[model samples]
Target: MSLEKKDEHDHEGWMEERDLTAVEERYLAILMWLDKRLRLVDYLELLEDMYYKVNLQMPKSHTEQYGLDNKFWYWYPLYALGSFSTLAYLIAAVSGALLGFYYAPAAAASAGDPTVAYTSVTSIMVDLNFGYMLRSIHRWSAQVMTAAVFLHMLRVYFTGAYKEPRELNWIIGIVLISMTMVFGYTGYLLPWNQLSYWAGQIGVEMALSIPLAGEWVAQLMFGGFTLTQATLQRMYILHVFFLPFLVTALIAVHIGIVWMQGIAEPH
Candidate 1:
């Protein structure tokens, strides 16, 4: 209980008294060192208590309590949608990182010539080994993640899982889905091809259409009133830097809330 460190021999004495093995002694030594500086032991004890509390027996689910396992099994696939989305997101993230090493986001157009970004993409597809498949996988995974997230939202809506205690999670889900769209849009522009160029133009127009903050949004997002190198640069930073951190943090919080609240069951 004392905050003051007892004699070094006291910890040693305690360990000796416990007849700890070599591994246990080393572990205790490291833990005590860390505890002295960080008081990690307190947090560890709190987590241990929470673990036991969570393990305490609880009433069974409505299906389990009512002996309706057969009916529950029919609906199990819906419950897996969230997990499917998470898996797709992870796959996209890994593949995107790999593709980023080879991607360029320049948009300096040359007459009858590919832009630097487009040429880089062409090189990846035509020259780099496995680059075509890697890019394809990344693109497909991103599309899959978007679809899975949409379906997951629909599942949550129809099941009433977003009601009552889950309203905050519902809101977070909305933000995450919007962010997913933004992620896709930004990545789509990184190639800076004809399609990407027009998409960036549309984004600028959309931003410029907002009533009061129109020009400001345009300047901040597209980097000018027109699609150019600055636009590509902004999209690249947003896709590779900003959104990844924001979305990952939001996903952790979203899942943490669900873990804390327990999954809502359709009764």
Candidate 2:
């Protein structure tokens, strides 16, 4: 309870009186300091609760409750698809952030001239050192993330991991998949190349095909019926800014839920 350090000898005197050795003294001193500042004791208690709750749901282990210990299940490899997808997502996010330093989203084009956005991409590939490899890593990581997510969903579906208490996680997984697709689509539009241009035109027409608020939807999403500066800007913001924060938050929640529920192992 006495927090006064008074002098350099005070901590040593207190430790000597308690019969604590050098390492024990230092460790306890640091621990107590952190406990006072951060309330480490409370969080440690919560962690203790989670550990027992997740590991010992009944009088036995999770594997015993799920009856996996007695079986020779060949599906353990597939169980890691969720983590693999998360790895791919992290790779893509980091690489994309590095690429953001060189990317431009402006779309002002002249006769027989590439737009500013397209020129920036060209500069990144040609002028910036190692830019080609960075772009390649970003593109391939995104593709890998997409594929891994699909395989993860299939595994969840076929294994019935979407049942009962995990229903919320299942729903969250669906939302994550949709967001991943949208993230890819928006990234596809950032280059301002011919392919990206035509693809975005298709997106615009699709939005316009919606029954009632077609024009409004197009205006909101694509910034008009045509691919313009606004469209490029919108895609840039969604892909680079908004979706990162949204997806990261959802992934955190998804992992937190998993931590609470424990994994659905084989039976």
Candidate 3:
């Protein structure tokens, strides 16, 4: 028999010796099949290594270092804001992705009927099943994320957690907050409603007031000095494509740094 056949025969023999149940035997067979193609074992080993490094190298917090052993602490709840914001962000991302399955970005219209974007949104809310609930969850989660992130920033500032060793993370946090605002603004304009149109106008003016780069900023961000189809397209791209990847990457780095350095405690 060939080496391949020999190996397969050996695997079968090993399994038969174990007297495995039907489910266990099928599971092993599938595991071997996938492992042959995917090299999943190597990745699992790497993940295991990373898990140990995280657990072993993570520094103790002030309370842990001194063994305060207090049942409750005032600042403990404030420390949870960062995690709470992360949870909210995850909820928004998942709901937004589901919403994307039914949303359209086009803004074509005859005169003053309704843009394709608005119609799609209305259809989702009124026609599609459970669509309203999904949209509400996405909107509320985004709002909660914004509030939580703002409060987290304030907590960091008041606690002096932005100093020295954590300065880079602090800067990253600021960038994240700014991007969160951008995310909210882009999503707000997606519906193409009356309020969104005026909001887009405000954004155009703000972009155009940026000293030397005003016109360039306005053109790049809003596609022109006016709010047209291009403006909506730009907002859609920024909200769905650019911002999510950038923000998620930044968040991973931010959380990884915090994990490595340990959460900064108030002095």
Best by TM-score: 1
The better candidate by lDDT, 1 or 3, is: 3
- Candidate 3 per-residue lDDT over residues 106-130, each given as its tens digit: 8898356999999899889999999
Return the TM-score for candidate 2, rounded to 2 decimals: 0.77
- Total backbone collisions for each predicted model: 0, 0, 0
Which 10 successive residues of model 2 have the least lDDT summed?
Answer: 68-77
Residue 78's lDDT within candidate 3 is 83
Candidate RMSDs in order: 5.0, 6.7, 7.3
Task: List pairs with backbone clashes in candidate 3.
Answer: none
Candidate number with the higher TM-score (1 or 3): 1
Candidate 3 TM-score versus the reference: 0.77
C-alpha local distance difference test of each model: 0.90, 0.89, 0.92
For model 1, the superposed segments whose C-alpha errors exceed 4 Å read 1-41, 44-48, 109-112
Q: Judged by lDDT relative to the true structure, which candidate is superior, 2 or 3? A: 3
Using Cα atoms with residue i matched to residue i, what is each candidate's TM-score against the true structure?
Answer: 0.83, 0.77, 0.77
